[model samples]
Target chain A: MTETAVTRPTEIEWHGVSPKYIAVDLIGTAVSALIFTAAATVPYWLIQEPWALIPSAAVLLVHLVVLVLTPRRIRSIRYALRADDLLVRRGIMFTRLVAVPYGRMQLVDVNRGPIARAFGLSELKFVTAAASSNILLPGLPAEEADDLRDRLVALAESRRTGL
Target chain B: MTEPLPPRSDTQRPEEREGLGSPLTEGRGADLAGPLPAGNPRTEGAGFEAQQPQPLQSLATAPLTTSLADGEWHRLHPATPLLRGGIALIAIVGFLITNLRDRFIEGFLPMYRDEDYSGDPVEFLVGEGLLFWALLATLGVVLVVVFFFWLSWRFHTFRITAEIVEVRQGVLMRTNRRARLDRIQGVHIQRPFFARLFGAAKLEIEQAGDDANVQLSYLRGHEADALRRDVLALASGAQRAAAAAAPAAPNGVPGLVEARVQELLAPELDPAEAAAESVVRITPGRLIGSVLLSSGTLSVLAVLAGLGIVSLVTGEPIAVFGALPALLGLGTYLVNRITSGLRYSVAGTRDGLRVGYGLLSTTNDTLPPGRVHSVQLSQGLLWRPFGWWAIRVNRASRSSTNAQQQQTRSLVLPVGTLDDAVRVLELMLPGFDAATVQRAAAAKGGEPDDPFTNSPRRARVLRWFSRRRNGFALLPDVVALRRGWLWRELVLVPLPRVQSVAIRRGPLLRALRLAGVHVHTVAGPISSAIGALDDADAQRFFDEVATGAVRAAGNDSSHRWRSAEAAS
Candidate 1:
């Protein structure tokens, strides 16, 4: 896929998420996956249906695969603050790169989950007038997240174009 | 005369004055006369400065603005209560009271409780010779309902000023909605079946936000039309001097009987405002054919046939009943579509595009220039034979519920010939040349000279049949996404309205070294996505569209289309 990487200009500097996000995301994914699997097998606990565990096992397998690729996925999440818009790219098997204009930004939020907080990391989200452009850049140092929010909010205010 | 005008210090240069003044006064000077040039922060402040004194000057000089535009609150039509579901509520209550008189009386008056035996409440009331009492009680209930309706109507007042249209509604929980004239996306007038009988219409002032539309339900039909024109005029930043002189007001709201008679006698099309003839007319035969050939109809037919086959083979008629509800739903949709298609009209008016349709309940949606975010022209498999296409647009105004109804409203042209489709397309994307529209509309791909950068041949593994057809073209003003070999869809998104640009590649696409590109616009029926292009092409498209959108957004003064036209 990188064979034609020349198409992307070399000048733009892309920023990647924190490496520690891999551990936090993997733990979160594993906990949720375990809860779901346990919930799905509740029927087995009640009626002792062996087939219910089959579906539960399948869910566990999917979670295991996700846990294996968590680090790569985290490393792939990158964002760049361009002159007039912010560009965010993530995913390996299913790659997505989105460019959202600063003028259209409706709100910028910085939040940290308990696990991410323990890791001293926060997530920065950008909401635009268009609902589909859901840009959430997760796993930044707390200070960087605050600084980025202030800078982006300032930029948005300056460029406040109507929808 | 008492208020001194701001000094015209910058009036020495006629061009500067023309550029700064309202478009109606500087009609021929549009290019440089747009109220605010994009990217010029100071011009926006200057625009407010320039507009503040114009109305005061108009008041002094003309003072002939319509009574409705006098910057005062106006009550809705007198029968607004009846038109706003009051009759239905009363009827439901009356029916319930008649059916459950015993329970109704017992619930309210325990002294009249009848717990012995309940055969029929109405029968019991009659046997007890309480029918008159019941009737009297019903009359009292009706009076109470009417009182509430009056209260609601009294509280729902709307005011229009030079800068904004404000609607204050609610009996207790007051909700005030103000739509800035500058941000008005469109003005729509809808006359429901019952409302039409009363010769009233609902005027909706659509702005760009969630649930922010200000609706003045049940205005006199003629009043709605006149208000739409006036609101559009003001929103366009046009001087109201000409409109003030226009003789649109009727003497007064006529009585119900006379109004109904007038409605019946009046021509369907308002000759003065809506053009006598639409730019494209969908014939009855064509409309019927399009409905019959629509994918929805075909799918319904398929399900019916499938059910019939299953019943015939399995000897189980119950299977058919399983799909009865689903079939009934689809039938209602088809019926609704056919009726709405009747008497459909799409015409270009001086203000912008005027689209009207309906047999009993009618709607005329006026979209000012540049309000359309994106447009999708699609040809169903059955439609291809007749060269029939439907055009739907993405607009900023989205109703929170009944998304399907909202989508149907977004449909500018339900069904039209290729030529008709082209005409509608040209109207929607004003600045595009006919050649570009035709190229985008008729391009079937595989042509070396086609303007679009098509998917690479290797991408055939993913697209299969649509390998050659799936492509995108980035025009100076719009980006076109062409897809589907059989269904055949072309989505054109104005660069300025593009909220964002995304390039994606799923596992399978990555396996084949292919990518997809999407030009994001406001959420609506139109999908502005193109998939399975050469990875390189996708990357280039992402970069180009990103930069193009930024540049276009920076220069976009389309919000004030009339003034932009004056400047250009």
Candidate 2:
């Protein structure tokens, strides 16, 4: 009697992704900030423009903010797989909960970048027919990622069966 | 996670599931795996090609219908590859040639002044009569494209059976797609200007799911027409069986309507039906008015005025030239709209709705019943005075090559009177008739009427810009939302199409005792929802939408509930 794709957040239990995601974000922010700081020095040295210091100083401030916020940001990212749908809740400030029903999922992509691979983590991307309904679950343990991908594919197939 | 349905294959491994369950390759795998006896229960000790065991394979129970026993391949009309997807291939090759030329010249530029090179590569090539080699390269590129087109055409094939209609073609990642006849919503045979010259037409067999539809292009126009008829006939036959299987309705009229729905769903593409009821037309005056009334045009004018003011203040007359691109862009947009909306017309076909419009590249789209996810009857700022509604729907399309095409194609009626919008809406949502839609549209925007529940004044400050025009009307099956004063948009979200609904209360809204109702639908251009309604009203709205969705969801449980073992 209680069967169907009823997307209730309360019923769907979400699990936090691998904590190494904090390290991943920190590394990413550090690298990008380092590059920006280096590039900002060129204009500063060439023109001795007081404005150039603003960029380098801004980069340091950004790095500090990223370092402080990375753990909390990582903590806020969670994903859940219900019987009939995949749920992803992300973003620290502007929370977004995208629930992609299993029947609606067209593609399941498990992408592993260099940094992710180094951390033994992967991002699972769920592509639905709707262009904007794609959900990305970043920083899941590699084994869990593959497991989720296979489970989703199987679930989608079974749900689509007899339809 | 608990699976609702118990495991059918106990011993199936993860890799096996991956191999057998991938939606794109599942059909090919079933046929290619040499017919496993367990999967193909009917083919037990029987010849593989025999399709007729029992006629009603709803594509519900058995999705991957094996290839015919004969293994006969039905290729597309020879020119299909060249006509349909050839331009994209040719464009890529042209882009590569131009990119190569520029790259070669740029690479030599660094070395031209060094000891390794004496002169400019461009001059040397042209001066040395190397243009012939470039021409040869171009010819080689064209040949490669021709070879690909040939391969594409060679691989492209389609087969029609009683159960499903399938089109299989892909050069590298081969796709074997099957469209279940029962799920067939609409079929269109389209011929573009050039394709018409070639006497070729494309058959679009739109089905239920985004992935399941079949588009077979470049068939002989006559053959395409015949094939379209055959598909519709087969689909109708299946639907007829379903209608019989469906229980008798409480009222005799509902039963008749059910049969009529099926009839409308499978209208014959005959010449007579082509001249069916002409429901609405976009007159020249309306077209021009809508174009001028477009918020986009006013914004362009505003930007232009701002640029003029800046130029005057700076006393640099040439500074006004910064507005050139904006002017040119606005002009181009106006031309495109005029061209496209020149002959916009919506006609009622036997099965559903047929909307045809466009001047340069005309598209004749047919939407069978239950295809539209939602509809929006919007009136731009200027159109408010004239009382023109631009009716757009989130039509049944999986993907579009470009966002612009999505907007253009979703327009069933670009601009019309209030009655026209109602007519089109009722056509899409038959249960909600013209009177219902008319009343819904003309309802008062403030206070709680029978149909409408307006936002409270506390929420108005939260609505901010769209303070005046914010309200919602609740019908049995649809929830109509009115928002935006400057660019007034009337959004109608069909209950069944409402994928997700949530009552959002941000810090500001919560403090103001106001909450926002957010309705999520399949992603499209229109984001339909009203924000900053009274908090208590928002909760009530959420419960009502949920009830509507659950009640309607039963109708399309994908026949799961009906076919469950415990059911009759």
Candidate 3:
């Protein structure tokens, strides 16, 4: 006897992300700036000239601008999951659409950095079969990210069982 | 007849069908039955077995014989020699650097008359303690070399098992890594000049893991090839067995290794027959002219002239010019051109199209339809008059480096018409319509769809000598533009592969509503360019490419197989 197809409820869903993404970005920027400042100190002290200062000042200004711009950019980021694919859209002026099919997913890695832990958020990195590319959903709430990861894993397993 | 026991249902009698389904049943069943005589005393006395013994009777009645199996699992090639060599090279360089520092302080300081020794205690120390430092430095170099050799001996271990290949390495922080046989994509055997002379080839296995690639240091040339074939067979066999077990998978999925191999290497046109299909033949004069006109040849000549002048002034022996380096460069170039000319043949066949070209190191690279990743046609200003375009294909390989090596196997064609390029692309990418490609080639002018198009967003800044001289900037934005006589023109920014992109604007460009954008891929011998563009447009393009990159990153299906579905 042929088995009939079973009707399963929608398994994939999108939950809202954590709000501490700004903090992570700021920390990364500050660390970068600190390293740059340290590296520049030697040359700055050696040259002791206004001309040398121009280059350093320009670099610092660029870094500051990037640091400021990142948070604003993060504010526009959003993600969604349909039955078959995951979608991520971000960018203010130039919109980007990224869709990842579930069948292609290799593994899901959930990571929590020191800052992320302090802020009670986690990051979900979905690695596809391709060696070079990974889709990272950052600034996710710790419990929420874990739950979503479990759901995705379960869906993948169910799909494997011909459900 | 005695009431026949109800015939056992097919569902309950799996053992009866087992022999019927298996091809090995005849041979294996004979072996099993031969040991047990057909007329057993116990069975004959019973006349009819009171009841058929339980299916598990074989296990319960079989005598236990324990003898250790003789065959040991095969081991992977040891990577120690290569690792040691690399470590030694690093150590030697480090030693040389330290020696150079010591020599500068001890040997050069005393000879320098410009420094006043009485005023400078540092100079005095260098002059007096030169001998002491030299002896100590020599000892240090010897010790470092000895230590490296010692470490090489202590820390290398590699083993290939039936199911996995294992590597155990590192001295202080030991790392043990294992790659399952089923996960191995392909084994690449590489033999550099020295390695070939030593009869050793390096084996690299591309696997789907964090390390990406695993390398075996050295194996005998023939042995390496044998090992490669064995590994490939095992991997493919396992894949096939898995697929056979679950036959519903998609066609392109993991289990279709055999299918992929067939599709990739299928022969369309025989190279021997296609040799006669060449329409455009290269004359000796053209070959010579091409060699002379090439940038590589010109650079070699320039270097030779510079070296000749230096030798003349220095009164060094000019006979040294006849040595191997000078001859190799010129000889290889000439031979390369001639071979390229000889192999200039493109022909179509049922399987696909074939283009073979090369000289001293002749190479034939086959591309089957539907396997091509991307195709690009390039033309330059000089080639515009001749109406020629160069075609290139990007194909996926398990090992990126090996794929690159294979791509360099031959310059498929030095020069071909735009139509020829389209013809080749059509076969390589089946869905790529010739008409569409031709249309894209023809629509070159106006606002081209090329991502590198010159836009109003680009900054046009000319550097003035001393801020007074009316000369273009010394930092020339080298844009290589090529227009085929028959087809479209291609503009190359020569920006390398663009690893990162940085947007910068100087006061002048900022005032002019322009910005300088630097796209960094991989830095080769050539310097990357900063394309001057309108600030907004440059930013927009940069953002778009970045977004595209993100999208591409999200959909990495490099190892995805259509067959996964079928198997599942």
Candidate 4:
């Protein structure tokens, strides 16, 4: 039995990610991609056919596409914390968003790898009791990450304490 | 003239409480057996207020949390250690004795013919009284086990303090686990074959916090039952602590003291559960019929028939043998499903609901108020004719790997009629409106013209095979996703339990102008996929679900007792 018509939700103001994080991810991917481009030469060396260049060219083309698209992919990864839930949106094509409620958050952690440490950035992770609900917001400024983490911990504590 | 009860703890002698708490635990725990609805108090609230002390003042009841108080620490039955260690002891002793005979045959006897030897080692050992040494070693092994058993029995103790259920165990690394009484969700009493014979059982007191479940085992059957009631009574009494402040029943608070004494302290299982009407037991015919009617059963039969045909045509006859792996794989899955769902029964209890199932290994889990986070009612392809629905819920588990696997752990009713499914759904979700739920369950076709927004006919070409069944139904507390044509599945995620919501438009879907609202829950079989909704419908559903989840989560408070204390 339908009764009340609900109002539309306000537009989500997404916070863009730190660019240095993208540069670091690009360097690693580019390095591995270069190795693949180099490895593709093996078939050309052994087969000694002009057609083999087509295969080698394809690998280089894939690497080129990745080099071009990697930055855009990073730019697409955005997160926003609302009044009661944390919303993360990523992927340009598939476009996925997870709105994790503050009350449902069981654990929140900030992790920094060596590259992220050099870049002064870290990943903020929210762990909920649900198996599928774990959300990782990557490539955030270390300070921003820690601040968000503390706020998340505080909000989760307050909301959960309502029981 | 009468003073208001001082939360039960301030007035009663500790000795009297200890007497009422454990003595009735032996057998007839009928009084304390009713489930406590907590702050959602009705008749029992006043009764609980009178008999039990407030949870906060539980700290005032006991002065020390250090070394066990003389009477405070209750050891598991002395034979508990023996029960745990005896099997290992027997096996080790048996192995050593058997090893001696084997050694005599292989090492000693073979030495005469000489396979391999290092200067008659066996003969030298024999001369040094090998039999005596062997016997001594066996005795030493037995003695060590006996010593450890005694140490474990002596040190391990469980006690219900004013505010917490404390369990302390271990000889060297002593662990004191205290479960906050107010946070206690449920208690499970497991009676294993060996323990049941000795009239002993194990109590697992479930709390909301991780690894916070208090497990104490091998208690005399009666004592175990009483301790379970004791914990529940104190937990429920925590809510009524405020009611205890008033001289007479104040503002709709029921008889908490009388409820605690007569309903919780009296010895007997919950009377409500004992009545046959409260239970839905699976019959043998139903069990067999469900398995035979299952899609899995049909697929297996189809595969076998195909293999048989292939074997006949080819005449190699090895085709049947080649498909053994697939046959075995499906066999295990079929067996697992049947056994897991076999002999299942869901019963209503004072606290909430108790679900027991398993053909070979059974689990009797008690789910108290508000433990379930989400629920799903699904109809499989084959079971549609039978009007059977499988009701599964997402309850926070102890520890799990991922989401989908965890959903199966919270299975409330594996397979049941429409009525049984509704009854269980009501049990778990107290706030869910029954009328809406019934309407949703009875929904045959979720059409654009009907109640729900149907997928555009273009989706018919996209999902040409299973186009008819893909639709969604929105409720106040839950968002229902119905999918699949032959093996249909209905996934329901409570707004509050929604970890996140995703509006995904695949390249194909984007072209069709359809976006799916993918509601992610803890990994489980219940995947809420409200797919093929038009762009506007999808966007609206996503936004509304996101907001709904936020509102529901905000309304739920984890600590009601704390609020009650603040209010008072």
Candidate 5:
């Protein structure tokens, strides 16, 4: 009888992030992981010390687990456009759901990293008066991101309110 | 700080002083060449007015002394030069003269020629018979320093129009900062001990964002209050009314010495000025008791006891001695906390809420309606029996440069009882629901009669002590978060001030079917967050609050409170 997101009949339809986002997340994590391993194992390469391999191997193992979880992480990301706010939900083990009202939005930004742009993906960010309301919705097709940005801008304009 | 300028001119002509003050006239006649840009338009056509046998009373108040909102550039207090950097220059010159007094005596009289020099550069110059050049160089340096101070004072000017308050300053690279009147969060007047000696006060117009605040340092003390009132009046959207009815300087003209003596003797919070007496009376006993009962004091005691136990167990007295420095530091902090709590006052004014504090160097700030973003009332475990609560607020205005000033400014009520707390909240949030706030304050846990949606029993795993007490309520205009069992706390964030709503769940929370909620407001002393709520309730809370926030923001016309009234 316990209520959950799935059981709520009145809950609005939630949209999942693009599947291609998994590649972006994995590639981004792999690049950082490789850099971290290289930095950690520098002593082994410079002094031919065997103990350095322990740290690098441990880092590699962690990265491999993360690589396996990247797809589920992408699938976990969901957003819903309610009547007055844009609701975003993310994270698996540590779940967070944020609702940013259109009126309080100070700035709307659309950015694309090199890899994201290669995959025709863009990340949308919303800036509100409170710095704590750091909301970002990533992994949207470039065209869709642009369209969403324009729609949000218009909505924000119509419902503009002061801080 | 000994009367940096001659007092003769300032004391003689009360009439001329009423126009531009002694400092401005002295600066113009001393060095600056060209005639300044007719800065005082009001004084331009005052020939006939001046000739008439004026009413001394009206002339004393001097409504035209500073037409702040006249849409023209105006210079700051004439003492701005000395207050800014002239004091440093004076100190440097004084130090040089004192250190080289022997050299000077030897060079001039030849009687002390056998005396040993201080081995300074001046000593070497005198020994090498280059005393003339050294004296000339010192004079040159003094002249250059004086010229620069004068130039800076001349360049630093501020202008106030209907919509914006702009200040531009810089001798080389001109810098201009404009704060929109509509965006002004509050106006603060600070009188440091030295500044008060010079009959000056710093007027700061608080604005949002990083480094956005505009400061007009060292304005005439009497004028600072008037200017702040005019600015607040304009910011409240009563520009026309304020321009027509700006309060004339309250007291009639007193001579220079009389005025300074009056200012020095004035109380921290003048009952005459703050028409509505302070809502709470903070007796000396209560102030000291509150400080001693604070959690900080308890921690200090705990550390001391631990040190004593360690010393006894180890049979080493040095253990206690080792903690002396840390204990002294903690003791100093406690003493400071108590001293600063003295002379604190908060009252309601016609324009807004007035809060004044500090003993020697006082600060009086006025926050117009709707400026406060969130309010928090908290009680320590030891304070429970006394029914004491401390109130703090999250406001958009902050002095980013000074962290200490920023912290003290946010605490509207440092300590008070439940009734006093409610009254202070009412001052901040006009027409707030007192009954709901009372219930929120009084509830211990699992109070079915209370309006707040109490956390379910399942949250006990995560918040064993606070499970029943931790909850949130959606009031008519604000979202209230009630938390803590031993240390009770409540936070109220106005619906219009809520920037965003968030719900979070970690692995433990998920297993217990509980979630945490955060109602984002401006960054300040208060944090509007609560944990261990029913998962379903959390979701519903987010949905309803978000929707309510949007509606509240749309309906909010508090920004131009007076303007709305005028329009209707």
Candidate 6:
């Protein structure tokens, strides 16, 4: 017997994810770098004076480079539902093409942090049986996320029934 | 209902009549039998008639057999002893802590200085002061035990019903927990040295989805064994019943060996050709040489020697003597390796494949094809020249504990050609093609003609003090990628099993547009790294692996659940 493909919508419209996610991640990195810089000063205090700042400056430069590179490297992120699979494509320099089959879907959790709430965005996390199958889809409109979740759940249930 | 009276003369009541017939009337003269003379109306009465019919029918059928309607119910084994012992142990420790406060403080404090001792001499000199404090502490402990006894009686309750086992505890906060008979995974019985001496074993009931384990502390040896046997019997019986009802073969059944054996031994060398194949026997010299060449063991010996030398220079007597035993231990290891190498052998069997190796602790492991997760063949710089490769099989149950995990190494073969490796792989993983192995091997050394081969696009390749080549891809054509550092190699792990993938950019890498990728697998804490790559390439590989992982994981999850259901 030939297998029939289950069709689903190609594109889902979700609200734009909260800007706070990016801001928080960026700020956290910056804070950590600052702490590292402060810690590095101890050696300078002990022995080296002018050279300690050199190492600290190098660290700051590296941090700045990372900060500048990440956003540029993250290409247009989009998720689409095909007949049998959910596909997510992200990254610029190193493009990632991830496809999670509907039948394998276990649990879908939606969380909105304080920052996400401020920006009217939410995060969608999908967990499967294998530990590595966990995925975090950040920065989506709440309504769109809800719709996506419902559609995904329906698709998963249908597949489970061997539709 | 109404009470009925027997038909009798006015002189006698029903209670007074004992025998089948009235004693006063039976075989008597006219005077005694006068009351029984013609047409007694009492005998014809309805009450007398009803009683006579009922009693005669019941007696003729059978003696009236009546049993107690309110019989005793089955009571479960008590949890009292376990609770009492646990409470007693805790109480004793608490008592020691509280009552010995002064002595404990004195012992813990650094050697008391004369200048620090400022207390009155008279109080310190009087032993009565100490005695008074000890008595007061003893009274407090007694009160605590009394309270605990009351709590234990009130809170501790356990029951093993026909369907499940339950434990309800807590005096003030009452919590009740029950484990279904079906959900229990395994019963682990542990006996510590002291517990063994006291003839008690600790039982832990392991279940799925629960972080805390249900423990039955200090069960008598016989009782623990009996409980374990009952639980196992119940579990097995239920499984067998389910299997009988289901038409299909259960998943994860031990009998998969038949199919696996067929798959594993399908490729057979011609009898004559097999005999012609030369076996690499480990001679005494070779064994000793290999042991001496082992970098790990040699380094350990070197460290000890260095320590001995330092100690000798410092004129330490014990350190000088320690060197002799260390050398002797190293000698013993060498001999053991030699003996083990001599016995090492790998051969094919109709059932599966068996590899036997070891000297004192000889081990024989049979790898039926179905249990083999993955097969790997590798050649180090030295082995490459000799055209020899080591083969290893990844199995499931073999990964759980240390004994099996350690035995996994004994399954490895020292001398095997590429063809042999291909044959083994084909047997283990049915669909594996020889071309894939060739391509993978070619990709590792940066061969040009290999279509899947990728260059080591490193951000930095420093040949001087530090030689690090970072960005490299092996087996780029394969859907599930496996790569590792030069120092630590991981083989045949599917992408979906990777728990995390991290991409790190160092200062030099940032300048050179390069990064390092580390992939974490689920075996344990330690993760494998595929280091030193250009940033763009690393990110692309990361994304590809992640995508593949997601899909593979989805497939595995559904398959696993289906298999588990089938097993049940």
- Candidate lDDT scores, in order, read 0.75, 0.62, 0.45, 0.61, 0.76, 0.45
lDDT tens digits by residue: candidate 3, B153-179:
445445443334544445554554545
lDDT of 1 by residue, B1-568 (tens): 1111111111112223323343222211211122322323223223222222223223322333676655566889989987778578779879977976777678789887646755676668888999999999989988998898888787777767665666656665656555556567888888888888878889998876555577899798887878888888777766656557666666687787987888755655577776447878988889988988888888888888888899999999897896798788877987888888888888887678889888887888999887898998999988887888999998887677667769777999999987888888877788775576576566678786888788888988878888788898888788888899888998899888888889887878877778888887887787888888887888889989998888887777666666654445
User: Which residue pairs clash in candidate 6?
Assistant: A15-A141, A17-A139, A94-B540, B470-B532, B471-B532, B471-B533, B514-B535
Looking at candidate 6, what is the lDDT of residue A149? Answer: 77
User: B58, model 6: CA deviation in Å?
Assistant: 38
Candidate structures ordered by TM-score, highest first: 5, 1, 4, 2, 3, 6
TM-score of chain A of 4: 0.78
- For every prediction, compared with the true complex, DockQ reads 0.26, 0.07, 0.08, 0.25, 0.34, 0.07
Report per-candidate TM-score of chain A alone: 0.90, 0.86, 0.79, 0.78, 0.91, 0.70
Q: What does candidate 4's lDDT look like per residue over B1-568, in tens digits?
A: 1111101111112322343222211111111121221222122223322222233334355333222211265778777975676577569769967855656676567655545444555556767778678768868987987888887787776666655565556766555555455556567766555545455567777654334467787776555655554454345543334323312211343364554333223223334232234446567677667777877778887888898899999897798887797789777876777777766767665456777665433445667655555677877767788878778775543433343324445667877887888887776666666665566554655544445565767787676655565777677787777666666566667666676677776667777777677777644445666667677777778778878887876665422313333345
* Per-prediction TM-score to the true structure, in the order listed: 0.84, 0.64, 0.45, 0.72, 0.84, 0.44
Q: Which stretches of candidate 5 lie over 4 Å from their true place?
A: A1-3, A6-10, A42-52, B1-66, B86-133, B268-273, B297-328
* TM-score, second chain, candidate 4: 0.68
Could you list the iRMS of every candidate? 12.4, 10.4, 23.8, 15.3, 16.4, 34.3
- Top candidate (DockQ): 5
- Give the higher-DockQ candidate: 3 or 5: 5
Which of the two, 1 or 2, has more TM-score? 1
**B236-328, model 5: which lDDT tens digit per residue?**
765365455644667688898999999977775555456688888888789889989999888988888899999999999997897897699
> What lDDT tens digits, residue by residue, belong to model 6 across residues B1-568?
1111111112222222224222212211211212434533233332312212122122222211111001111122243443446557778889978975655566678465234433644236444467567667878997887777656544544444323444445554455454533334345444443444344555555432213345565564334544554443333322323322322212343344454343233222223212222233445554455456555466768878887888979988777677777778777866755655545555443223445455433333434323333344555544454444556643322122355334434245544556655555544444444575655542443445443323244422631211222233434222323343232122444443443344554455445555556553322222344444545566666656555554554443211222233355
CAPRI tier of model 4? acceptable
Binned by DockQ into CAPRI classes (incorrect, acceptable, medium, high), candidate 6 is incorrect
Name the regions of candidate 3 deviating beyond 4 angstroms.
A1-16, A38-60, A63-67, A93-96, A105-107, A127-134, A150-163, B1-371, B398-414, B442-568
RMSD of each: 9.4, 12.9, 20.6, 12.5, 10.8, 24.4
Comparing 3 and 4 by lDDT, which wins?
A: 4
Candidate 2 on B321-379: residue-level lDDT in tens? Answer: 88998999999999888878866667765356777666544456777655567788887
